[model samples]
Structure formats: C-alpha cells, structure tokens
Target: MAEPTISVIIPAYNAAAFIAEALLSVLNQTSPADEVIVVNDGSTDNTRQVAASFEPHFGGRLIIIDQANAGVAAARNAAYRRASGELVAMLDADDYYLPAFLATARRAFTLMPDIVLFFGDTEIVDANGPTGRLNSEGKPVRTLPAIEIDGLFKVRGSTFTTLLEGSYIPVCAAAVRRATALAVGLFDLSVRTSEDRDFFCRLALRGPMAFSREVMAHERIHGGNISISTHRVDLARNVLTVMRKLRRPEHACLMSDQERSALEAVYKDEFFNYVYNLSSAGWRAYVKGVAMLPADERLAALHPKHLARALAAAVGMSSND
Candidate 1:
C-alpha cells in the first residue's frame, strides 16, 4: 500500500502577518505535502501578496485561489475543489503544523484502511510563546502530552461518540480523506460560524477517525481571534441549530439508541449553556432561543426558571427573585 498524497489547504482572510509562518510550516514538513493550496478570501491586507509569493517557492506545487470576501467555509470549499491529493490537510491561516503532521496522517491512512479522518492535540500560544496544550475537554493546560508513543499516530476509540460529547477537534489539527470530504459535502456555508463543527460532525457520521496525543499544530490565541471577534450570541445559537440539524434522523440513524440518547443529552446541555450565556444579554436572545426550541423538547429542555430569569432580566428585578 502506498502512502496517500496530501494537500495542505489554507483559507486566509487578512492574515498577512501570519501566512508566511503557516506556509513555512508546510514547506518544512517531514513528509512534505504533495500540493499546497491557499485561498485568499478577499483579504484587504498583504495576505494575497504574502501567500501568492509562495507559489514560486513551491515550484508549481502551490495554488493560489483568489475569491471575493467569502467566509472561511467557502474559501476551504474552493481550495478543496482544486486539490488533487488523496488526503486534505486543513490548516488555518493563524495556525501552523508540527513537522510530523502530514507524515503522521499519511502514515495512518496507509496503515488503517478504514480510517478516513484524524485529529491531533493543538498547542495554544499567544504573542509571547506557548501557553498550554488543548485537552480533550476543550481547555488549555501546560500539562504533558495525552499519550507517549514513538509512532506518529494512534487509532482511538469511538471518534463519533467522543465528538458527540463536545467540539474539541481544532481545525488546524485535523486531516481527512478527500473522498470522505466529498461524500459528506465539505463545509456548510449557511452557518455564520461553527462551520468547522458542522463539517466535523458530518465527517464523524461517515466513519472512523484517529487521534494524535501531543501537539500536532499551533493554535494562536489573541484578541483578534475569530471566536473573539465574531458575535458570540449568534455563534452559540448557530451552534445549537447546526447540531440539531446534524443529529436529525437521516444522520442520527447511524448511531445506536444509547448514542442517540447521548446525542440528545449533549444537545440539551448545549441548549442550557446557550441560554445561560444569553441570560445577561436580556430577553430578545432568550426569546429567540426558546422560539427555536421544538415544542416536543421545550417542556423538558427549557425550565420555567430560565424563562423567569429572562423576564426578570428584561425588567429591573434581580434574577434571583
């Protein structure tokens, strides 16, 4: 069996300052990418110039797809359409991969014929340096790696089940087979945010996924990070919406009854979290979220106290009352 060819697809938007580092990481990969595609989604900065500059260095291995101010999902879709490799390595403009990332993923695909996707842990950083490594719980800590192994990748337990619990798989740390990507239809553009979550959820339904313990990629955390800049309320709301759609009968049918029950439990957990986050914002968001809740699930999912708090927040009264 031959190792799969990999394409590193980066979607950049006003990422001039960081694009070079990302490109360099790809260039320095132990098992270098077979193709490098960067889609400049209408960046006003030098992102286009900086990314396009790599074409010559790649010696025609680089592809620059310039498009209007489309979102990251669309930009990735464009790059994927142009990618010819058997595996697509999803890299973010603000993040860079460890030298072993592609080599590790390719080796996994070559070894495990059933695995279609895999993600590794990410090292969280800031302007200073490394802060901590992201854990399975979507948190950061300066702890040791999740697992110690001489090998590049580790085939894990139920990827789908773990993913159903939370959205911990960072975009920068994952790679998927090109065929599997097409089968599920890459990214969902309708979502304003959490498109990565949507895409990953769909992929989880497809088949098995692997995990890399230590740090496989770098995730930069700054004030200007997308999760910070984007509207949190809207993003959180869309997250629930997307999750509901993803867990519908068509997709949820693949899961056993226990899995489906677990899926519903998480959905409710997310719903309450969403409402709690909006409690301070006032009634409009609360009303919207409640309205979005289905009639069947409302009585069980939405507590009276939650509604009372929303009403209380709308008025001058304290929420405790």
Candidate 2:
C-alpha cells in the first residue's frame, strides 16, 4: 500500500461531547488525511465510545489507542509513533478543522519544499457564538499570504522571544513534516500548558516554518478549557519554567540580541499579568512569579511598565492580605 501523505493525531480525554465533530471534520477534509489516530487518554466519560462509533466510517483509515490518563503530551507522542504519513498534523479533540486545511497544506508544501512546518490562521468560537477569525494575538487577521523564509524571524523580531510572550501558532492549526517533528523530539511531557510553544521554538531554530493566511480551523473556547479557568497561574508557572530551560541551552545563542530583549519583556509582562489576573490569593501568585524569574542581571532588563504593573499589583495584594 502507498504511504499516507498525512497523519492527523487527536489526543482525547473526556471529549465525548466534541470528539465526534472533530472526527467528522477530518473525515470531511478536502485533502483528507491518509490516517487519523485518536488516542483515548483514560477518559471516564464516553470519549472512547464516540471514537469507536466512527470506526466503521473511517475503516482502516482510523486507528484508536487506549492508554491510562498520561496527559495530552504522552497521548500525542504515542500517536506520532504509530503514524505512517509523510507529514504529521495535530488537532485537539475539542477543535475541528476546515475542509480546505489539508488541501492548502499540500499546496504549500509543494511550493516550498524546504519548509518543515506549516500553520495557518484560526477561527475562534465560543459557546456564545463565533467570535471571528484571529491571528496568534487574538487580533482579526484577514488574507492569506505566503511568508518568505526570513520573514518568520524578521516579522517576529525574535522567534524564541515571541514564543516566551505566548503561543501565536495554535497547535491545532499546525502541520509538520514527519521527520522534522521526530528530529525535534516529541512535545515536552513535563509542560502542561506550553508544550506547543516549546516544540515550535525548537522547530523554528532547526528550519523554516510556513504561516498560511487561510483560516483552516476553529478553536473552541469553552468554560472547561484550561486557559479559561483558574489554572492560569499554573500555566504561567509552566511557561516560565520552559523559557528558563530554553535560555540556558547552547541554542539560546542562535537568537539575536533583539530577540533576547523581547524575551525579557515577555517575562516581565507574564509576571505582571499573573499578579493582576489572579482571582484567588493574588499574593501567592505574585510570590510564584517572583520565585520563577531568573536570578541573573537579566532580570534587571525588565520593562519599566511591567515593573510598575507588578509593583501596583503587589500593593493591591498586600492591602487585601
């Protein structure tokens, strides 16, 4: 049999309510994936059942793996190992892709044979309604344009620094060459929130990435999402830890000074944001951010605005305490 052109990996927990839609989206793709692998990560709900129901529809095209609740990173890694496609794409169980996703990716890869990664714009939807399509910053970005190789780092200023700010590249909207994904190593299992950011940083350092202007997926923002709930503190902590690890590595030298300065600004913004955004025990979160900041002189480079914000937040917390 011919090798599949793309493998779509979906890591599902208790996503019964939305997994069906996610599966249907892949099955309906204009340039359908060669294989769809859904890993049911010890879901207590009917997630397995929902995945099983689609078995007949996908036939040999769908492969399901059941494992104990080992986290999304582990589930994705397992699926990646089982995939036989030349390219690997990921979609969260709660999200679904547009029909043109794979078709555009195929064309992009054909045109830019050297590019190792491809990602496009996404439509952000919530329980209330469709909010509209957005770029990585949650800003409305219309028009799809092919980005030049240097444009990725040039526009972003610093790739690593931009990553420290936040995840602009939504994992669900990304497709990567199989070899490139494997070479970069699978997503960091230790990071619960910023695994995609860590993976993207590593990949960007290795090769060029393609950003498609097309909106090819819908990212659902529900109450149950990790980003929406109170775990924002945990997310902040994990992202800081990942950033610290990246900075200490020899690869950190690959980034320009401008990128490094941008990263410092991101660290300060993240620290201040966590301090002000905490609904419960603001002092505790502030303490956590302070504890996470690097000890070196680099901390002195934090933006004055962020420093002021952090100070204001600290005073507010102290008064409440």
Candidate 3:
C-alpha cells in the first residue's frame, strides 16, 4: 500500500536563528513529508526570509504563510488550515525531528489502524547539546508491549488516562490523522500556556492513541519556551481549565464509568494543588481558583483553615501563619 501523505505544520515566531535547522530536519526525513507549511507568526526577525529560502530546495513543497503577530496557537491554526495530507505532523521552530520520526509514525498508523494519534520519545536539547530523554517526575518515558507492522515495531494503547495526568507527548513527537484533527478542532487561543496539553487532551478523548519506543524528535529547552515565560498562576489556571473541559458532559462519553471515576479522583488532587499554588497570591486569585473548581466538589474539599490562611495572606499576613 502506498504511504499516506503527511503534511508538517511549523509555527515560527522570531525563529530565524533556529527555523532552518527545523526545516532541515523535515527535509532530511527518511520518509519525506508531502508538504511543509511554515507559518511565520508576526516574527520581528528574518524568519520569513529563512523559511522562504527553503521553498526552492524542496521543489516548492515548502509553503510559507505570513500572519500578523497573533500567537503560537493562531499561527498553528493558520498552518493547519492550509495543510493537505492524510496525516498532519507538528514541529516547533526550535525543535527538529529525528530522521526516523516520520517512518516510525507511519508504521504506527499502519499497524494500529484503529488509532488516530501517534507519539514517540523525545530527546531534550539545550545549549550544551543533546541532553537526555524527556521524563515525568523522575521516571523515564514508559514502555509498553510492542507490535510489529511491515518491518517496524510500535506499541498500541490508550494514553487518554496518562495524558489527563500530565502531558508526556511533546508536539514535535506526535502526529494525528487529518480527520481526527479537524474533528478535535484547533488549539485553544485562550490558553497561552499548556495549549498543546489542551489540544492533546481533546484528541485523546476522541479515540485511541499509540507510542513508539524510539526517540523520534528533539525538544529544545530554552528561555523562549512559552511554558517558561508564562506566570505560574496563569499556567495553573490554564491547567485547571483543561481539567474542567475534560470533565464536561460532552467529553464524558469518551471514557467508561471506571475511567470517569478515576478522572474525578485526579481532578480532586489537581484542585488542591491549584488552590495551594494560588493561596499565596492573595484573595482575588484564591477566589478565582475557587470559582474555577468543579461544581461537584467546590468548597467541599476546601478546608476552612486553608481558606483562612489564604485570606490571611491576602490581607498581608506573614508566611509564618
């Protein structure tokens, strides 16, 4: 069977220094992408020039879309709108795919015909150079039983629960069926941080997903990453928003009774964590956190002592209290 065409979407913002390496990575893919779409999201740098420079080299397969400074989510949505392929893959301007990345994703798709999303391990890169694999807490990326398709091996499973706990799949290391993406919709523009998590969570809810054991991409860790620049309170708020979205009645159809119960437990834990983080901010933030809590458990789990402490902090109480 002929391999399905894959379109790669890259949202770049003042990424002139690193965009070329990212484009090169796609160009060097063992199984070339059907098209490479680079959306220059109101870049102040020469990102447009750098991206356009590669169009001729790729025989016009490289497509560049220039949009006013809207934000990463908008930029990605723009590129996604123009993508024409069976599968849509994502890579950040500062990140690049390993040579075998596309091949591995295709293999996973072929073997797990029922799945819509595929992701693999990622190697973290920094100024010092290639560092190590991305992990959760201190645990390395988890392994699962393997299945072979054609000549490649991939593990099949549902990452919905894992994704709800925390995002382990980096955008650069994952691919989704174009149909699945359209069904799931675009990234949430309101979420400046953890937008990828929001997008992945929605996709995970839609259907099954799988993973490749091999490291298929590079995730660059730098000061420019949105997660690094966004305020902790705002980040926590966005996370809470995603958690709420997952628990909505419309999304509840995605999981069984047991899984839904498990998710509720997770949400309970996350609620406390959110409130604790906002406790020191002041009364307004603390109230906002409380307002964001799920109706089912709002204030039920919030101890009066914790509320008093939050109020005390809001009114200039010492940390000792």
Candidate 4:
C-alpha cells in the first residue's frame, strides 16, 4: 500500500474512434502513472465499452466512472473529485501524451520542487497525423519565451497578463499538483468555453509555472476540435469571460501589485485583439463579440466609427475608415 503519485485523467465523450489510442498512450508511458481514471462523460457512442475493455489489463489501477452527459469540464471535475493521486495529468480523448511526458515531469519535480505546475510544447496532429509538424502559418512549432528557468522557459513579461491574450500552456499537455488544482477550484463549470485558459490563469496567479520546450503531447486537430466544434462563436467571448472572472472580488489577493496593474492594461489589447479578429469574421460574429465584450468595450465595438472600421476589416479594406 503506497500512495499514488500521479493520475492520468482522460475525459471522454463520444470518442470511441480515438479513446483506444489515447489510453494506449498512457499505458505506454516511459514512466507510467500510478493510476488511470477515465470519466465516460455520458457519451452515446461505445466510448464506455472501449474504455472498460482495458480494465483487466490495468490490474486494479484503472478506475472508470460513468455519469449522465456533462461537458468536458464537468467530466474532468468528476475525475479529480474521485482521484487519489497527488498530481494529475490531463489527456483529452482525441489527444494523447508522448512516451516521455511523465518521465520529463518526474525529472522536473525532482529538480524544481517549488514549482506547482509544469507544461510543455505540443506537436500538432491532424486526422492523418503530425501535420508535418508545422503551425497554421506553415512554420515549425517552437516554444518562444525569453527567460529560462532551470531547464524550462517562461515569458519575459507577467505570465498572467501574457496568458490573458490567449492560451499558450496546452492544458492537455500539462501536469499539475492536485492540491493546487483543487485550491483554484478546478475548472469553472459555468463556462462552456475557454475554461482551460481560465483554470490555468488562476493557477498562474497561485505560483510560478514551468514551460518546458520539450514536446510532451500531441494535440489532434480533427474536425471535432472542441473550440471550433463546440463554441467557435464564443472563442473571443469566452476569453473575455475568463479575464473578467479572474478579476472577481474573491480572487483579488491572489494577484500581485504588478499582476493586478497588468490585468487592467492587458485587457485593452486583449479586448481589441479578440474583438477585431471577430470583426473580420463578419458583422454577425462581430455583433456577437460586441455582446460578450465588457461593458466599456461594448461601447467601443458598437461605435459608428468602429462599425465602419469593422466593415472595412471584414472586406479587406483599410480599417482607417
């Protein structure tokens, strides 16, 4: 009877097509997890059958729980709620970890005992596999922060504000201390999108985070991509929601004086960045962005002048209109 060191959590929903691959990734880890917890998230597909089939092999280390259909956020919440590990690594049903992911994390904890969380770069995969290892712009995917900590890298600016612009730490590829995840209240059940960004944002406020350039997981970009499939319209809106949530009265003390100030200033750029991008999607999406934008930002996005500018941006004309 020894304590479990880490639990690999796979939140599956209608992932029978890919759950087996995801499970094998965990089972084949260079440094295996102490236990594997899969929450069947009420998938109508044979995800349960596919997941449960591995039980006999796990030899009591596999725990599969079933519940009525809840979103991925809720499924993940349920796993951690019942998990008995000190640390948890998240793996989406469509995405899986590299063999060395656990080994790298174990080495990191041994070297940097103070870090509460650590994440690494991810190799992007498409329906066929490894999209030639390039980002959307056809450039090699590389981790790019200016500072080095131990063997990892971090942003030159405030990590919280840096994260505000968008998500850099791939939650699927990250490993976090269970206590820290619980202390931050896990993922917000209320938000249907950007919940991952929101959860990590809260974690960033709690302590230093390690960003290892080493590729730890493969992010599959099939048509079922969660954000695009589930909440494409809410992309900008959810980010804005997370920014506002982090600034709530209860979490005020979690931020430092500098982080607090940065939140205010960064909100402006983040607001413009997300909204303006939406504006290019068309006036309809632009209008949706306007509705989700903060009150002050709403006024700016709805202005007649900004409307003209949005039209120009949407049609490939000069936004100086």
Per-prediction backbone clash count: 0, 1, 0, 0
Q: How accurate is candidate 4 locally (lDDT)?
A: 0.76
CA lDDT of every candidate = 0.78, 0.74, 0.79, 0.76
Q: Give me the runs in candidate 2 sitting further than 4 Å from their true place.
A: 1-4, 133-159, 224-232, 256-261, 264-321
Over 1-321, each residue of candidate 1 has an lDDT whose tens digit, in order, gives 788899999999999999999999999999989999999999999999998888878888998989999899999999999999999999999999999988888877776767778778888888987787464443321221323335544434345555655467788988898999998899888876677767877787777676667678999887665543126667767777776876778878777676677778878787776666565456776777667778875665467777777777788576773
Candidate 3 accuracy as lDDT: 0.79
Residue 313, candidate 2: Cα error in Å is 9.2
**Alpha-carbon deviation at 118 in model 4, angstroms:** 1.2
Tens digit of lDDT per residue, candidate 4, span 35-54?
99999988999999999999
Model 1 clashing residue pairs (backbone): none
Residue pairs in candidate 3 whose N, alpha carbon or C atoms collide under 3 angstroms:
none
Q: What is the number of residue pairs that collide in model 3?
A: 0
Q: Pick the candidate with the highest TM-score.
A: 3
Worst 10-residue lDDT window for candidate 3 reads 135-144
Off by over 4 Å in 1: 132-157, 224-232, 278-280, 288-303
Give the candidate order by descending lDDT: 3, 1, 4, 2
TM-score of candidate 2 versus the correct structure, residues matched by position: 0.77
